[model samples]
Target: MSLDYLQLAGTKAKGKRPQFFADSDNERLLSILMAVAGELAVTRERLDTLERLLEAKGLLSQDEIETFTPDSDQAEARGLLQQEYIARILRVVQQEKEALEEQQHCQSNNDLSEIEQELSRI
Candidate 1:
């Protein structure tokens, strides 16, 4: 098994991506979503580089970049990234939540700050 992060979604022998979400509600939509996500990621990186170049050339200011907000489509893309992120990390998040609940029950009725202090001592 190769542990390549970029190929986690898998690909064919000819460098084509395999449809991992074929059984999804709308396979076409899923494929498009994945394509859009990939494109948006690349576009975002390129935009960041462009902004840095502009700033370096004194054409754009740091404040302008810092205060920038995405338009509706970019905002939606961010939402998609957030959803995909939750899907990716849900299991670990659940496990951590369960562990925290267990620790809360096992420990006294102290607040989280007290628990942190106790943990730091350990």
Candidate 2:
């Protein structure tokens, strides 16, 4: 989602940049957003690869295969730990998704003056 906004900004920059946009512009903002988007994309891809490898190796799996079988107490603890780690990851993903959604909503509907005022309060 952040990438989407960044790509939009980049495309805008590549075309005819308006005069007002250049006025009092935060010169570093667009590049920062783009860098952030790129890093995030890389991170997401790495995470996906890690998940696939973990699945294949029966470390953190989705199906009841050669994975997390409760034979010993240590096995049960390991399974629980993996489950907790996955759950934490899911929660973080959810939070990021929600933050992206909120940012979109704010961008689309909220006025700049309103945002500025809110920021001032902060």
Top-lDDT candidate index: 1
**TM-score of every candidate relative to the true structure:** 0.34, 0.32
lDDT of each: 0.62, 0.56
TM-score of 1: 0.34
- What CA root-mean-square deviation does each model show from the true structure? 18.2, 14.9
| CA deviation > 4 Å runs, candidate 2 | 1-21, 24-26, 62-122
- As a whole number from 0 to 100, the lDDT of residue 74 in candidate 2 is 75
lDDT of 1 at 1: 25
